[model samples]
Target: MIRAYAAHEPGGKLEPFEYEPGSLGDEEVDIKVEYCGICHSDLSMLKNDWGMTQYPFVPGHEVVGVVEAVGSKVKNLQIGQKVGLGWYSRSCMTCEFCMSGNHNLCQDAEGTIVGRYGGFAEKVRAHQGWVIPLPEGVNPVTAGPLFCGGITVFNPIVQFNIKPTDQVGVIGIGGLGHMALGFLRAWGCEITAFSTSPDKEAEAKALGATHFVNSRDPEALKALTNSFDVILSTVNADLDWPTYIKLLRPQGRLHLVGVIPNPLSVPIFPMILGQKSVSASPLGSPTTIAQMLNFAGRHHLEPIVEFFPLEQVNEALERLQSNKARYRIILKMDH
Candidate 1:
C-alpha cells in the first residue's frame, strides 16, 4: 500500500489531507491517479443531499490515471497503461442487466462515490472491468471528465438516434449541456439552446448551438410546437415540461438526464398523446462509454475545462454550483 493524499469529509465537510493506504483485493487494479475532476454529484453526496454518503467520504468520480499494479488474474491491463474510471465503481456482473449490457441498470450498480472510494485521492484501486483505455492524444487530465460529464451527454445523443435532419434542443448550458452541444454537432444535428439567461446565447452559439431560444419567451416557445426531434434536459432545476413538450414533434422525445433536488411537475400531454418516448439513462454502458470516447477522440473533440489545484476543490465545486465553470473543473493530484 502506498500513501495517498485526498480530500475527505471527516464528518461535516471535505478537507484535504493524507489518507492511509488501504489494501487492494486481487480483483482490483491499483491506479496512480494523475487527475480527478469535480462533478456536481460529488457536491450532492458531500452535502448529504443524496442521503447515501458515508462519513470520511472522498468525493470524486471522474478519474484518469495509470495502472500501478494489477492482480495476476487480471488479463486485460498492464502496469503503467493509461486508463480512466467513472461514476460507477462496481456492479454485480451476475445480474440480468449486466448480462444484457445494461449494467447501468443493474440492481446492484454501485458508484465510485457510494459503495467505494473515489478519485480525489492520489491513488485509487478500481475494478479492472470498469477501467477504460484512454485515447492516445487525449491527456489524462482532459480525459477525466469524459468519464462522467462526457458520457452523460453522449449516451443520450446516441440513444436518441439524433440525425442531421433532426432538431435537437439542449437545456441548460453549464457543464453537461456544453458537452451535449458538441456531441450533437459532431453527429451533424441542428441544435437549439434553451437557456434562461440571455447572456448565455453567445456562449451557446460558440459551443455549436445553431439557434438560441430564450426559454422565457412565451411566443418563441409557442412557435416551436412539433419542431424538435429530441430534447436532452440537462438542467438540475425544475423544467417547464409543459412548454418543452410543445416544442417536440410527433414521435419526438424529451430525454431527461439531469437529477433535480426536489419533486417536479410533469405534464402528461408531452408523450401520452403523441406516443413520444421519454427516457433517461443512469450513465452509459461500458460499450457505449468506449464508443463515445473513440468518437470524441476521432473528432478531436474536447470539453471546455478549467484546472483547479487539489486543495481548491471546494472553490471549484462552488463554481460549478454558481454556473461559473465553463464546462468542467479538473483537479490535479500534486504528486
Candidate 2:
C-alpha cells in the first residue's frame, strides 16, 4: 500500500493514511510525488465548501514527480523521468470536445481530484495521456503550482492572443493573480492589476503590473472605463459586472478562470454598448500546458512558494484557506 494524506470528511481533517497501491494499468504510470501544491479547490473539497465533493478525498491536483514505474503499454515516458500532472485525469478523447483539443471541457472528463487520488501523498498513478515530462533544471517544488494556477491564467491569455503592447488587466493579486501578472509581463504585454486592497499595490507592481486600480474606488473605476484591451478575472469573488465590463475596450474579451460561486450580475446594456464578450477556461489542454511550461522555463517565470513537509498537509491547507502563503504553498513528499 502507498502512503497518502487523506481527509475522511469535510474541513480537511487530514491524517497519514494508507491505500492499496494496485498494479498499474496497461497505459498508466506510477509517479513518486516530489512536490504538490495546495490550491483553494483542495480546501473547498476538503470542507465540502462546494457541496459536490466525495468524502475520504485526498485533495491535490498540482502534482510534480518522478516516474517510478510504467506499465508495459506505456510509451513516450520512462522511469526516472520528471513528470507533472494537473486537474484533468482522463477524458473521452473520442468526444467532439476532446477531438477539438478542448479536453478540459469534455463532458466525460474525470478530474484528478474526484475519480482519482491526487498528489497530496507519496505517489500518484496516472494515465500516460495526462502526464507531461518536465524539462531539466526546473525545481519540482516550484513546478507544482504551474500545473494548476499557472496554467489556469496562462491558458486564457494564450487563447485570447494577448500580445506585446496589448493592454491587459489582471483582476486579483492572489496566487493566480501573481502568476497571471508574471506571464503577461513575460509575454511583453502592458499590464494593469485590479484589486480592492490598497496594500497590494507594491506587491502587484513588483510582479510586473504597470498600473493598479482600486476596484472599489469610484474614481479609479471611472478612470479605467473602456481602457483595457483584454481583462481576465483571477479573483474568486463576485465582481461589479457593469463596472469591470465597461473597462473593456471595444471588441475586447473578458476571460474568467476563477470560480466566483455567485451568479454573474451584468447589465446587457453595458456589454452591448461596449461590444464586449465573456469567456473562460477550465485549465488547459495538454498541448497548451506543455507550451506554458516551456515558456515559464525560458522566461524564468515562477511563483514564490512556501514549502512544508508532507505531514504538514493540514497546516498547508489552513494557510491556503487563510490567504497566508505569500503566493503558493507546496508540500514536499519525503521520498
TM-scores, all candidates, are 0.94, 0.97
What C-alpha lDDT values do all the predictions have? 0.82, 0.86
Which candidate leads in TM-score?
2
lDDT of 1 by residue, 46-74 (tens): 77687888766777888998999887778
lDDT (Cα, 0-100) at 301 in candidate 2: 83
Output the TM-score of candidate 1: 0.94
Give the per-residue lDDT digits (tens) of candidate 2, residues 240-303. Answer: 8778788889888888889998987777877787678988878988888898989988888888
- Going through the candidates in the order shown, the clash numbers are 0, 0
RMSD of each: 1.9, 1.3
Ten contiguous residues minimizing lDDT sum, candidate 2: 132-141
Candidate 2 off by > 4 Å: none
Clashing pairs in 2: none
Model 2 has an lDDT value of 0.86
